[model samples]
Target: MKFSKRTKLNIILLWVFTALPMSIFLYYYYPSQPIDWSIFMLMVLLAIATTAIPIYIGNVTIFFSQWVTVAAFLAYGAGVEMILVQLSILPMIFRVLFLQDLPYRLIFSSWMFIMVSFLSASAAHIAGYQIGSMDTIQILLGATIFMFVSLLSNHVILYSRERILGQKEKFFSRDALWDYAAGLVTLPFAVALYVLQLTMGWLAFPLLGIPFLLITYVMRMYNTAERANIALAKASAFGHELADRLSVEQIVNMFLEHLKNLLPADNIYIIDNLKGNYVVMRALEDGHEMRIDVPSDTIKNSFIHYYFTYSEKQCYVKSSEWVHEAPDFLKNDMNSLLIVPVHRNKKTEGLIILTARKKYAFEKFQLDIVHLLATYFAVSLEKAKYVNAAVEKSETCALTGLHNYRFLNKTLEIEQNRLNSNPHLILSALMLDIDHFKQINDRYGHHAGNIVLKDFAKLIQKNVPEDAVVARYGGEEFVIILPQYTKEEATKIGEKVRQTVEIHPFLVDSDLTKNRLDEIIYITVSIGVSSAPEDTDETMSLLRNADRALYIGAKQAGRNKVAEYLK
Candidate 1:
């Protein structure tokens, strides 16, 4: 197998920039340095430190191990310092292998470290730090120079690579400065350790451990805080998404999708309290999802039953054995379970139950995060309920529960625009009126007339296709909007409505004050059909044409028939 042209060039450049210097350094200086035991230990220590855990601050990463590198350089001469630099490449080797880089790239990376280490040694020598000397000020100067050289070399390489690759990002911006700042923090401490070693002998080595451990602990704490901030940010983003959803099912599904990714479990169940029963709208078992309903009473009596009762604390069961009273279905193929209640207005609206195949699957911090997410779900659920209620009230008629005049006009306008965009598409409109509705009201009662109108709305809803919209236009009148229907198809639908209403019996109570019905009466409706691009393109024109047709068919034609608009 042959390498790509780019890869070949990279390999050649790596050898020129790194391997050449390494060969020269070894030939000129390797024989003179006799491997001092103490210096070798320092070299090994520096290598280990460089490879250990790295602390990320903002956009920059600080490797606390570099402190050991500086100490090795200050205590030993340029030759030992150079060897320490070459050995420090061990960590980079591991990283390159972990990333699965080519073998050539790993060799290049090791050489890159060697070259940087040589430059750092040259800077230290220029700062007047001699081999094995105990000069405190010179040690400090060399340490400072070493840090600056290492930082500059790394940034230069990064900037050059990005420029060659045609990247848009500026490599030498404020973020670079942050990286320099991170290294600066460790420099002073590394120099301090060298100073202590000179004054206190071998005892000073333990002194380095004290501050190293302290700094390590501080970085760990910072990491914990950073993770918490990220979790909160994720929860806040999900909350905004949940608020945009209009239905309880939509909100619950969205919340569950995000929750599954954030927390892994063998099984997850979202049980909603609908009509006083716990119905599982979504259930996941070993990654497969299904919907099932668990009886509310059965769920309440289970070992995880505490979730039904409102409480701030989450019920975390680490082992199934502890839950001896758990339901048979729940206990089957489960080792651990966690139950959290979603509360709204101090009432438990629902429960989020998680099960794991292994015991003690969830940690304390994970449970805390789950509780936080559940709270977010609860708040969003309540908000969606109110939003849906307000929308329903605005769109529906209060008396008949059908789409009102406002919705009718809005729908007609929308359908008109759709028809305008597609000239070939058809939109059919119908104007319907009950025959002798006023006479019925005067003879029977206005309340009886209302019952007939409501029954008429229900009949229209049942007779029309699901895609058609039936709306109450005004008193004793209604409109039906059907998309993709020609005048011939709409006339057929209108005829069906007329026949159904003509034959059906409408029950009414003879006594106005009583709720029970005692009488049955027959009724009929006349319908006018008008279609878009066939009758008229305009919405108001279509409505007027249909109304005129209704007048001709119902009034002039002696009522109870379907009429089509004549051009």
Candidate 2:
């Protein structure tokens, strides 16, 4: 990694502060007194075994061999403790030079150990901690203080280097907690070693390797459990997010996005076959999209059909088999696939296909989570379909079989936004009303009136321009929204409706006999035309202006006349 100028300067300052004092201390306090060759060799052997397997917990590397240093401190004083700790750094340095590890990291690790060793030794001395006379309480207290000082110094240096390098990890994070826990875990071992050395002398050193391996195994299991808990937390969060979605499209999008975050794949396809037709929503890792429309019959005859028929609810196909069994369209450049069938009412509703470029990209845990998500997605799909059907029914006008006022409100709001963007685009609103509609109801009964209204709506729809929106605004008042039409063009269209209604013979069913009337009744309509951005740009304003013009120019003047807003 390349360091910025600021980071380089910070690393330089860290080396100066920690390495300078540590160099001076090591030089002045070097074990100059006559050394015991036998004990020295034993200490060296202990140091090698302790630092052999450096447990990597997040960004920090920990040696479970701190018990050896603590044991040496209690047995042979500060000189032997410092010498044993320094000996551990030599193996790490050799690994960096010959095993091609980063020299900067190893060098920093040496400095951290040296600084931590000085503080821990001083803490042990202040606590009156000596070899044979120390009780269990003194040993525990000294070990705790020694561990705390080492951890604190290392945390400070780690955070300083990370901050300078623009790293986004917290100082007192999971790794620091694990380091503290490791210290606590090694305390009993350290105490045992100290006691054994006092009694058995140099013979006790070889037994350290057994406890060190057991600590390594226990720490590995702890790390695995931590990762599993994290995955479960994410799955729970995603489940809540999926539950809150109101539409099938929204739920599908959220599921796809959440799945990508959990396990990244090169290509993903969600095949929803429950809607009578098959819709394949495909997304590439690079963010390109492909929406495939496959006939349901094709799916029924393909390998997917066979799987749904014979296989269990969840399916996993290896790359070698998937390539041969998958359909031609799905076989395009995909290596591995995971297919999970969404279940509802004890039957499969749809299938989710996860594809990646590499082989064996998915794990058992990810498949389990995908199965859980698919259940929610199936429920969301059913709810969305029911809601959409109800909304469609509510927006329909029962008498004329056209859009009601509620639907008109939504359409007008959309049109007004469009008019705002394209100021030059012509939009015309025609307010049409049957002439003497109340007289027709009273003369021939409501059944005849209903017939007349339905026929009139049909006539208006048939005569209006293509792409025009027609809706029943209320009883006997209909609205025609003509897009891309001027006031003159709309007036001509309005004239066509007025002429057609005036000439066509409207059939009114007999009320008493429940049969068609022999004589056809003729009716006319009064139309008021208003163009958007010409008369008014607002939907409500345009509507009010058209209604006003209809009353003044059509109804007041006489019915069966087409009138445009004067102003």
Candidate 3:
């Protein structure tokens, strides 16, 4: 949990206010009786052990150390009990602040524990708890007051902190109920320890400590298994969703979105390896998407190169361990990192780098989840690649490598719909035919004619606007669709293509029987242009008008000329 600067300052002020009173109270009520060093040490150790194995319920952790604190309070006085409880809070602080990478939790948790301890101890003292007395009624009364005050104060502090931080957490929840129930359940154990200690002496500690430790261990294992099951269920659902996506861009976007939900990260980078050079394909930083273009040599000197060369997954808990090899973009405010290589058929396809602003931010379970997602991502990407290839094959001309007639028809239909929706939009079409093409085959063989056709396709493609769709219309004929061009503009482009083709030399071998390489041949083309809503409102009429102009205005007027359909 990160907090705003104002929230952090408010929490620090709250801690100061609570700690000051607690210090003064402890000073005034310092234990007057001589302390038993052995018993004190035993209680401290037991408190530490119990605090370490807490039961997690949602965002709240329930520690059994309260039993130890109550027992210490009954045997020694409030002064000793407060010290013991405060010392026991160290392990929890370490776990929440460092292990969990929650910086704001350090101040909030410390103040919360102090407030709970002081209020509960005050309640027990007010209830007439006489230290070293074995009266069962006083014992039960003091213990009940202690536990009740502790539970209530714990929630009160939690609710207060949340309110102060301007968070919308409910005051009452199922987890809160669990906290109260857990407190009730642990009360008897504290009573038993206090009563049995007078009878069994040192034997009482083991009798209670062993079973407490055992139960804590069992609950910890159950929590781990439950979390694993939940994570696996999410991963299975994510994999199914990825399978439904049909493009690489969609898969990458979905992968990053799902990953952000499943894990905590400050920055996520998807680096693609194309022909042995790493390129940053997509990057998500602080909830925004961007692209980072770094020099190849700069990337080579970073940890991305290390992962490619080694082909092993890596998780660094602290930036200091790997800072020297980090790229420039990742050098600031990034502490933890998990890098997983996306593999397809035993070869590394790309790399996924997840980074955080705090140390030890990623756990082992999160690493496992990332590996599973990477596998799913690779498989989906491969499927989309093959599907795209198949679609490209169906729409491309095999000989000329240009859009085939089928694709041309589909494009014209799509453009016609667009023109119908927007009357102001312009669309133009060009029909082109090779002049005396049969003579090329008769004089220079069919193979030479095929070479000339391929060259002619390349020439038209090069001479047209990039957005223009050039297609092989049929044998010795080609079509071009200019989406935003008028009749005048289309005629200009048609003239350009006709002039280039007339002057260009087609290189082909005149004979296949002899190995003579270079034979120069020249060809000319006749072109006609038509615009939608000017010559006709429909797609078929647009092509028809262009063809009519090609034959009448260009072919009949003499080949190697450009003409537009006259309305």
Point to the candidate with the largest lDDT. Answer: 3
Superposed Cα deviation of residue 565, candidate 3 (Å): 6.1
The candidate that achieves the highest TM-score relative to the unseen native structure: 3
User: lDDT tens string, model 3, 1-567?
Assistant: 457788778777887887767756753664424577776787788889988887766556788888888887777766677678778987776544333326556666766766776788778878887777789999999899989998899888888767876888778888888888888888998888878877887778888888988988898879867876787899989999999999888999999999887777888999888887878889999779987998777778887897887778888888788878888877466788999999987988788999987667777787888989999999999999999899889999999999998899899889989989999999999999999999988877888889999999999999999999999998899999999998999999998998899899999887654665668989999998999888899988999999999999999998889988887
lDDT of every model, 2 decimals:
0.74, 0.73, 0.84
How large an RMSD does model 3 have? Answer: 5.0
Predicted candidate 1 versus true structure: per-residue lDDT over 266-285, tens digit per residue: 78887677767666668877
**TM-score (all chains, Cα) for each model:** 0.65, 0.60, 0.77
Clashes of 1: 0
lDDT of model 1 at position 62: 56
Score candidate 3 by lDDT. Answer: 0.84
Residue 234's C-alpha lDDT in candidate 3? 96
By summed lDDT, the worst window of 10 consecutive residues in model 3 runs over: 95-104
TM-score of 1: 0.65
- Candidate 2, superposed: residue stretches over 4 Å from native: 1-228, 274-286, 295-298, 310-317, 416-426, 465-467, 500-505, 512-519
lDDT of 3 at 245: 95
Model 2 weakest 10-residue run by lDDT = 94-103
